[model samples]
Target chain A: MTKHFVSDTLVLLGRSLRHISRSPDTIITTAIMPIAFMLLFVYVFGGAIRTGSDRYVNYLLPGILLITVASGISYTAFRLFLDMKGGIFERFQSMPVARSSVLWAHVLTSLVANLISLVLVVLVALGMGFRSGAGVAQWLAVAGIMMLFTLALTWLAVIPGLTAKSVDGASAFSYPLIFLPFVSSAFVPTESMPGPVRAFAENQPVTSIANTIRDLFAQQQVGGDIWIALAWCVGLLVVAYGAAMAVYHRRTG
Target chain B: MSTDPQMTAERVRGPVIQVRGLAKAYKELHVLRGVDVEVARGSIFALLGSNGAGKTTVVRILSTLLKPDAGTATVNGFDVATQAARVRESISLTGQFAAVDEILSGRENLVLVARLRHLRDPGGIADELLARFALTDAGTRRVSTYSGGMRRRLDIAMSLIGDPPVIFLDEPTTGLDPQARLEVWQAVRELARQGTTVLLTTQYLDEAEQLADRIAILHQGRIIANGTLPELKRLLPPAKVEYVEKQPTLEDVFLAIVGDDGTDSTAGAASPAGTKNRGTR
Candidate 1:
């Protein structure tokens, strides 16, 4: 059964990757929004904002990367919605393949696609004078955190994907996710905000993740924020995974 | 009930799909009220019904896609609710809609199913199925580009990848053109000829008449009638003799408009005048 799960997931993942390859536009479209936000923030508002940091782009890149993942995962929800509406899910369910592999394939595809989009955003950041002297270990940490964040969000996306009545509803859940970065220290310092706004800006998962990635990029020694970020990622992943599996079993059964 | 020798022989050979007092309800609405069906092996069994007659619910339960709220169903001697994996291994379903991935090429879709079924040489199996379905010309094209007929054919080809003994086709030709419907019927017939047990659900009476060895009419969540064609006809009142001459059926006209051979020329020549006659019928 475990072997079937692995093989089926690989086959279905190949199908989804082929879909991405054929319509390279889904990735490009996902990357375009974050890249646009990055440019608008760095050039238009970079000099005006003060974080006591020399380059605003460096501070902004982490947040932009998070937004990229946020936007990219909407496509995951959208694609899964299409699969659910398309009757392909019914066909897959009727097959002898492991049932959970169907959802795993979509989740893993989201990870791969978002990783590529993150790489593209980082490349764009490098060209925009964003510099990091972080070692390979820090880079790996950044990648690991981003992947965990993506997995958590991707599984969260699967809920709406499975239950949404329309394509718009499936992808619409990401609006608040994209809006989250604006309230975080993505563009400005949380200390500069009002008391209530600062509380919100500092408490959400986005803020911790952005702060953690920002510190790693600057080669700064990390603090408890890394634990908070990991907790948020792992916590959300567990809850979302459980809820998504429950929904999937109820729907398919 | 009058029993045909052939039906008796089929019953003796044993049923491949069996349902006993199967029931499902959604809150206040009971969609299937104690439905029972026994489909013999190596024959085409048609469940005939109108819109919202719970045809799809039955198919879903039998294929292990949906669980019954009460009672049980078994496919190939395996219980759908408990031995679901075993049931799935012995059955394939082509749902009402074409279930092939629209982004993948027809060949890719087939290969994907073959590989998932753990078949040796998925590429070879895909090529053979494509050719068998006469989809070789369009095999390289994405399913999104194929016409409705080609998509349905590819869907069936994908279902057949594992050569499962029992196949469920749920309204397979629902939205197809007449010519395309004929092509699907021929395919279903071919499957039966190869000794595969087929359980198909449809709203069209003519489709049941054309393909089924046994037909069950489901009305308002109950199997109101179940028999072979002759047995079903026997349940109705005998026809009265009339002084009027018999007229050719609309199906005859339809066949004339779209040639019996199902080629494009006759369909192209079909006129609005002929269509108007068809609508009145």
Candidate 2:
């Protein structure tokens, strides 16, 4: 059974990857929003903000990467919703293939697409004179955190993908996620906000995640923020995976 | 997946598919209630019904996509509920709509299914099916670019991969033109000739009259009538022989006017050189 699941996942993965390769606009569109924000923040709003950093892009890169993933996962939901709408989901369900492989294939495709989008955003950051003093280990840690966050959000996206009535409904869930980083330290320091807003901003998942990635890039002590970020990612992943699987089985069954 | 010894022994005898008092219901609507059916091996069995009847529900339950609320169904002598994997191994489902990857080419779609079925030489299988379905010319083109009929043909071609013993076609010709419908009927006939059990569901009575060896009329979640065409005809009074003029159906006139000879003519219409290609082919 496990063997069939593995092989089936690889086959379906190849199929969806072909979809991504053919219409590269999904990845480009995913990267576009974060790139726009990065440009807007660094050029238009950077000098005015007091982030205690010489380059605002460096401080902003982590949040921008998160937004890139946030935007990219909507395509995951969109693609899965298309499959469900197209009747292909029923086709695969009725076949001898491992059923879980269908959702896994879509989730993995989202991961790969998001990785490419993240790289594109990073390249744009580099071009805009964004510099990181971090070494290879720091880069790997950052990559790991981004991937965990991606998987968590990707699984979360699967819920709407399965249950959405329309294409727009499938992707609309990401708007709040894209808006999440704005309220946190992603843009400005939480200290600058008023009482309740600052409390909420500092307590949310994005704040610790952004601070961790930011400290890593700056070669500063990550402190307890890294632990908090990892805990949030792992916790969200578990909850989202459980919820998504429940929804998947209920919908497909 | 170990097969039950009793099921293996039973596989050599009786019907290829059997359903005993199958029942299913949504929250407030009962879709199928105590439905029973048996399809003989290698026979073309049609579940005839109009829209809102439970034809699709039966197909879904038998194909292991849905579990019946009550009763049992076995395909290839394996229970659909308990031995779903084995039942799945023995059947392929071509859904009401063409369940194809629009982004992928025709050949890619075939290869994808073949690979999913764990068949060897997926490329060879895809090419063979493409040729068989007369889709070789448009095999490399994306499915989104193909006409509706061509897409249906590709959809059936994909289902043919691995050549499972039983096939379920849920209104395969619902949205097709006359010529395309004929091509699908021909493909189905070829499958029956090769000893594949076909369980087809459709709203069209003539399709069942033309294709099925046995027909079962499902209405209000029950089989109101079940028999061969002649037997069903005998259920009513014998036909009175009266002289009447036979007129050609709109389908015949449409096919004649289009001059479609089961070729891939409609597929070309979507391409830039469609007209030129049609003339040459």
Candidate 3:
């Protein structure tokens, strides 16, 4: 049964990918917003923020990547919304295919699209002198971490996609998600802020995650942040998975 | 339209759908209140109702899309909630609206469904269905650009990917033009001809009169009437005499019974426009 679901998910995942491919705008449109954010932050605002680093782009790249993911996940909800509104989900529900595969397909597609968007942002970042001497093992770790983060967010996207009342409502749920990283250490050091502001900024998931990824990229030894980051990723993944499944059951029950 | 109508309608020996005490309610509104129905195998069963009558709710429940607050319903002898996977495997639902992916071609949409259903050769199934639906020329065009009728045809083609034993169509012809509606009706008949049981929900009594062997009239969350066409019409009023040579249209009966503006077929047929009901089995 598990194998059937996996294979079916893979196939549906491919279908979603094909849809994405045909309309490259899904990824392109997603990339455009974060890319603009990266450009605007690194060139316009980078020199202004003091992170004790010579290059502001370096500090900003990590945050931009998170923004890319956040932005990309909205498309996940958008695509899922389109599927739901289009009645395609209803059509799938009637079929004998693994019921969960339908949801998994969208989740996996979100991961893939978000990854592509992440890579696009990274390529653009490299052009802006964002360099890392991080080794293959560290890079793989970054990939794994980012993938987990993406999965967590993607599953979170499923709930809004399944439950939202309108097209805008589905994608609107992701705005707060994308905006969260900006307030965290993704854009700057938490220490630079005041007491209360820094307290919330330092304790949030994005800060821990961005700090861990940035450390790995800089070849610096990642300490407690890595575990904290993983906890956040895994924790969100579990919670989102549970909520998505609950909503899915209610929607398709 | 073909030979042996009764034989085609009765091929499946047992009941295809069985429901008892099915109920669904929103936070404060009871959409379906203790509704019950049974659809015989291979029969084209039409569920008729006015807005808020819970016609689509019943289809959603039977198709495993919505949960019922209180009810026991089975499809192909498998309970909807417990045997959900089995129920899913046995049926296809073409909802009131078209659900094709805008970015993908009509053919690609069908192929995607075929692939999702784990068909041996997705391309072949897609190709066959596209041809069958007369959408071969439009197959390669992105669905976003397809006409409503074309999109609906592709949606129907997509639903047949698995060729499940039973199909649910919730207001399948609501927005379709007369030609498109006829095409859909023909498709429904074709599926039934191949021995697939169908549960159709619609406000168009003529559609019900044409497609269904058995009709159930849902009114205010209850099956106010249930039986064959003759039985249902009989339930309403005296059987009108139409010259055998000229069958009396529903318009004749409507004018005779309702006087003006007709019965509005719109009343109690579906939940008012966008106020969609939530259902589960």
Candidate 4:
């Protein structure tokens, strides 16, 4: 049974990936926005933004990575919405394959797609001079944070994908997610915000997550950001997972 | 994983689906009200209903996709609510549209589903299913390039990868030509013969007449009638049987009488048989 779940999930994941592979545009589309943002920021906004660092690209890359993931996940929701709308979900239900495998496959597909987009963004940042002296541990740490964040957001995406009445409803929910980084420490320091905004900027989950990634990339002391980031990621995962499961049960019940 | 026919045979004996007092409601809309249906070990049970009459809703509920507001149902003896994973494990579904990913080739789609079901040899299963569906030639072609019928066949084949017991087909062949519909019907029949209990929903009464052993008519969120074709015909107040040409078609008389709203003095004209129409809204 466990084998069935794993295998079925792999198959479905492949199916999802195939769709993504065919639409090379989706990956390219995902990479484009962040790449545009990265370049524009580095060349245009790079000098004006003060972070007490040698270059804004180094400080900004981490937050941009988070943005890439956030943007990439919207596609997850979009793909999931398409599948749901296409009646594939109904088709999978009749098979002897593990049911949860369907959702997990989509989740795994999101991870893979997001990873690719992240890599593309990172490569673009490198070309644009977003260098990091961090070693294997730091890279691994960055990857870990990105994956957890992806998982958390992916699960959250599941809710909208499953429940939305229309394709627009599903993908629209992700816009706020893409815009979230702007409010946090993604492009600018949270300390630079106005009094009321600063409190929210410092307290929001994305700030800690962005702070952790920035520190990890700069090879600076991560301090308590990593712990807070995990807590936030894990917490969102738990809540999103629980809510998604409940909604799934109610819908498929 | 187990390829033994005897094991497959044994798998067929168990009641693939069991339902009692199943009910579904959407805020003030009662979709399925106190519906009870039990599909025997390996038989085709068709639920006939109009567009909003809850055929897909019932199928969804049975396939472990939609939750019923009130009811007790099981797939392979697993409670749908509590044992949802098991129900999902035991069943497969094919809805209105071909759910195959257009970006992938038909073969890739099949293999993907195989891997998701945790099958041992995804490629082998994909090959067999392609052969069975006569899709081997088009296996490598991206689904986007395939015709509607091909996509539908691939979708059904995908559902069978794990050899699930209860398969829910919700208007599986909605937009197909006559030949394609025949192909799907042939597939459904073959599945029944192989001991798969199929719960099919169709707006096409001919499909129900041709495929179902036991038919349940759902109308206005409730079951108005349930029985065989003869039994359902018997319920229809002896509507003036017709003797047509030697090569008469079901469509000819169906259109003359059931299709029209009682202007022809021969249709028995009794308010258009409203209790059920299957998947039509």
Best by lDDT: 2
Q: After superposition, how far is residue A185 of candidate 1 from its true place, in Å?
A: 1.1
Q: Which ten residues in a row have the lowest lDDT in candidate 2 chain A?
A: A1-10
Model 4 per-residue lDDT tens digits across residues B1-281: 24343565475555567788889888988888888877776789999877998888888787767778898988777898887777777778887777787887898888877766666788999998888788888889888898777777888888888888668888987888544565577678777767777899987776787788999988887778988888888775533222211112653344445543212211111222222222221
lDDT, candidate 4, at A152: 95
lDDT of each: 0.87, 0.88, 0.80, 0.78
Q: Which has the better DockQ: candidate 3, or candidate 4?
A: 3
TM-score of 1: 0.92
TM-score of each: 0.92, 0.93, 0.86, 0.81
Best candidate per DockQ, number? 1
DockQ of candidate 4 (2 decimals): 0.52
lDDT string, candidate 4, A98-206, tens digits: 6688789889999999999899999988888888889999999999989999999999999998888888888788788888888888888878899999888888888
Give the DockQ-based CAPRI class for model 1. high
Q: TM-score of candidate 3's chain B against its reference?
A: 0.81
lDDT of 3 by residue, B1-281 (tens): 12243563354456879999999999888899998899988889999987678998898888888888998999977899898888887788888888777888888888888777777788988888877777888889888898777777787777777767778888988987554565577677777766778899998767788789999989989998899977776566433223211333433454345443211211222211111221210
lDDT of 1 by residue, A1-253 (tens): 5569999999999999999999889999999999999889898988799988899998899999999999999988999999999999889889989899989999999999999999999999999999999999999999999999999999999999999999999999999999999998888989999999999999999989999999999999999999999999999999999999999989998
Candidate 3 at A244: error in angstroms?
Answer: 2.0
Candidate 1 lDDT by residue in tens digits, B121-142: 9999999888878888888998
Give candidate 3 regions above 4 Å deviation.
A1-3, B1-12, B237-281
Listed models, DockQ each: 0.84, 0.78, 0.74, 0.52
